[model samples]
Target: MFEFAWPWAFALLPLPWLIALIAGKQKHHSTLMLRIHALAHMGMTNTKVTPSRKWPHWLLAIVWALVVASAANPVFRGEPITLSEPGRDIMLAVDLSGSMREQDMAYQGRFVDRLSVVKAVLSEFISQRRGDQLGLILFADTAFLQTPLTRDVDTVAQMLEESQIGLVGRATAIGDALGLSVKRFNEKSQSNKVVILLTDGQNTAGNLKPEEALILAKDAGVKVYTVGVGADGRNQGGLFSMLGSSGAMLDESLLKTIAEQTGGQYFRATDTQSLANIYKELDALEPQAEQEQTFRPVDALFYLPLSGALLMLFLAALWRQLKQQAVVGDA
Candidate 1:
């Protein structure tokens, strides 16, 4: 729809018409005349010729109308739009043990270690996420924060890339990882916080037990999705160097119990493909509702009317100049 922002300016449109009427009605002085007495008695021929030019006032009035219309500032109305979405905050707990280096899981038709496939697929996963706050926790024997809960996924991914096994030693502390993740979630309410824990081995170090950490998560109202990652027996070759053979073992039962206690489901990722699928499924889960937001930018349209006024003024000026030249030639 079209509308004028300054509709009051339209009232000025009639001013030029009133001025033209007054100017046209003004009286001009009579020219000097001399007459002889005998000429009054003679017969005379009379012919009527109608005047072709009465007024050019309408041209000037139209120019003024254009100027006023231009000043009114017209704009097009925009349509309303609707969008629906859920809101939630998520924290990802990743295991950085040396055993994660085992090359037994198949991904994209090739075999890569649990961590290698995870890093690749999860990086893509993080990129696609929107409107969710995310954080990262890396654990070995001890737990360390790769990043705190944040809305910036790129920072989280960069921290994930920098994670290595030896930062907290070669031991697997599932409890400490959960505890740290829960501690980070403490900053937010339980209903809004969630944890996705991925590990390849049972807990070996940490003050808290798996059940105890789950209790903390339950009290906080934070949901926990536990993912146990590793292949079956003999996947780790005898020639393994950086990671010992013991790293390949996964405590699935403990992970299940933790998830169940926190009102979340546990998942087993025996291969990289299954791990990727599990994360994708988690992405589909709905989050809590958040406050809605909107923004609008205004655009000025005064130039359109101003251009028309300019053209009208130019035409009037040209017509006046041509009339003046013609009068001069006739004289």
Candidate 2:
């Protein structure tokens, strides 16, 4: 409803009039000084003000009222709107090593590369995450932050879909991925920080080691969920189980250690069905708040009265100038 933001400002409504009354007792003799609050005084500012030419006392009072009303901060408060903030921050670190080129995962009854399946699944996953800050990391020979933490899940999904296998290098860098995630999480975290690390091979490249990254994440209170993606029957031109999980066999033990130490879980996605289940589990992560928040929108209306006051002042000045010119002509 329409109201004054600061109702106490109305107390100043009589301030200008009080000043007028007090000044009425003063007596001064000066031929040059203007004796009233009129725009005419602007031309003879140095003159001592005295009881002289009749001023528009009523106009001045109306102007003062308008100015006082503007200062009171009139506003129209809108209805309260409930905001459903997700409140959680998530980082998805995907392996883009040469091994990810393996055609182990089946899509639409046809074999596709590991990265393709990841892009499809994760893009859908990213779309459902509303109000949560999501980030993307692509790792191969090393780790790289593809997208910083943001609420724009559509952009995050676009980045994920645009990724190509072996874009960085051909070797997996699990430690570098985890370490990079930790650094990002520390940079901007409001609530919980979660890392979903997906890889089809063991950590064979990178400066940092898996054990070292694990300690770093645990110390920073960063939770990690490790996903090992390679088919059990990796032979017959699939992916793993034949060449032993692209470049090297899946390091289940290291993945498990990292997850457990960081207070997370380890999931093996040998197929698309299992990966979907993993998504369900990830969805269970705690949000920033259990209850929604609400806030009222306000629109300031002070400008309305403020504009009127300025216009009245301008007109008064113009009127005083006109009267002064008429008097000079008459003289």
Candidate 3:
């Protein structure tokens, strides 16, 4: 893929030779003592002048021509890459109410809270989505955008994992979460816009209603997938159940309606394995489009050829000076 960007400059390569020829024919007069002729007169010693050491200058000129050619930006194009999986933009809306601390979901024969498992699984999920712009929204009594839509998935995940329950008070504002997600998505609507809403309770707080938020999402061409997490029915008082002190049930119908309104589906994750499976199923819902991109590395090949030419010029000049000094010494 090597190419000379300035092929027209080759025409000037022979111009130096013309200058050399003209220089050789230029008339010049020099005075010298002619003892053999017994001429004391200042006679004309003019003769056709030629370079005694022409090869150095010729090499120097040729090298300079090459340097000029290299400086014209000779380029080597590399192969292009096809990013088969086109990136998408996703916003994860998580519920961080007091109920999220319920330790009903079992993981490896032990019960863990909803948030613990969510963090563990989400960390892995975010890793798989490279090149995609991801965001985080945590909602409880009020919905707050923890991170804006960005390509930095690591930062988004870190912020999500660092979030604690009751950051905005202890109430589940499902509608506000969806509304905020819709607003964020509308800020920069991409080819594929999505919101993964995970909540363990119903909307008890926020200015907007669930139906109103769903309408906003539909209007903005945004898809909303709702996930209702926690075990179904009620759990009797156990040794370490956080919900043992109170009675509550997750609002599946509202979550289902939100998902249906925005061309998405509702997923019920009662346990860790089911939650993992639900996310795995979601992985297939949105297929990435193949994209092609071109990349050209801007390498500075000028230094290579320039350095070589400079070194040659230096050596030539030094040799000429040394030859002149040697001639003077011999005389």
Per TM-score, the best of the predicted structures is 2
Q: Give me the displacement of residue 235 in model 2, in angstroms.
A: 4.9
**Candidate 1: tens digits of C-alpha lDDT, residues 1-331:** 5788899999988776677567755522221121232233232434332223533667666667778887888877666444324266788899887777777777889777778877887888787666667889888878888887777889988888777657778777889889988888787644377899988788888888887888888888878998887666446563342355433457888988888888888988877668779977886664436655553334677788688778877877788678877876776
Worst 10 residues of 1 by lDDT: 29-38
lDDT by residue (tens digit), candidate 2, 56-103: 788878888898899999999999999877667889999988778788
- Model 1 residue 19 CA deviation in Å: 30
RMSD of each: 9.6, 5.6, 5.2
Cα-based lDDT for every prediction:
0.74, 0.83, 0.77
Q: In candidate 1, which residue ranges exceed 4 Å CA deviation?
A: 1-86, 189-191, 238-248, 287-292, 298-331
lDDT of 3 by residue, 1-331 (tens): 6666666766776777888688755532222233433342224554432235655566968686867776666666566644534478889999898877777777778877778888878778887777778899999989999999887889998998899877888788888999998888777735588899998888888999988888888989888888888776355444324543222477888888888888999998878888888879888987554565656654445566667888888888899889978876776
Residue 133 of model 3: what lDDT? 80
Report RMSD for candidate 1. 9.6
Deviation from native of the Cα of residue 255 in model 2, angstroms: 1.4
**Candidate 3: residue 137 lDDT (0-100):** 95
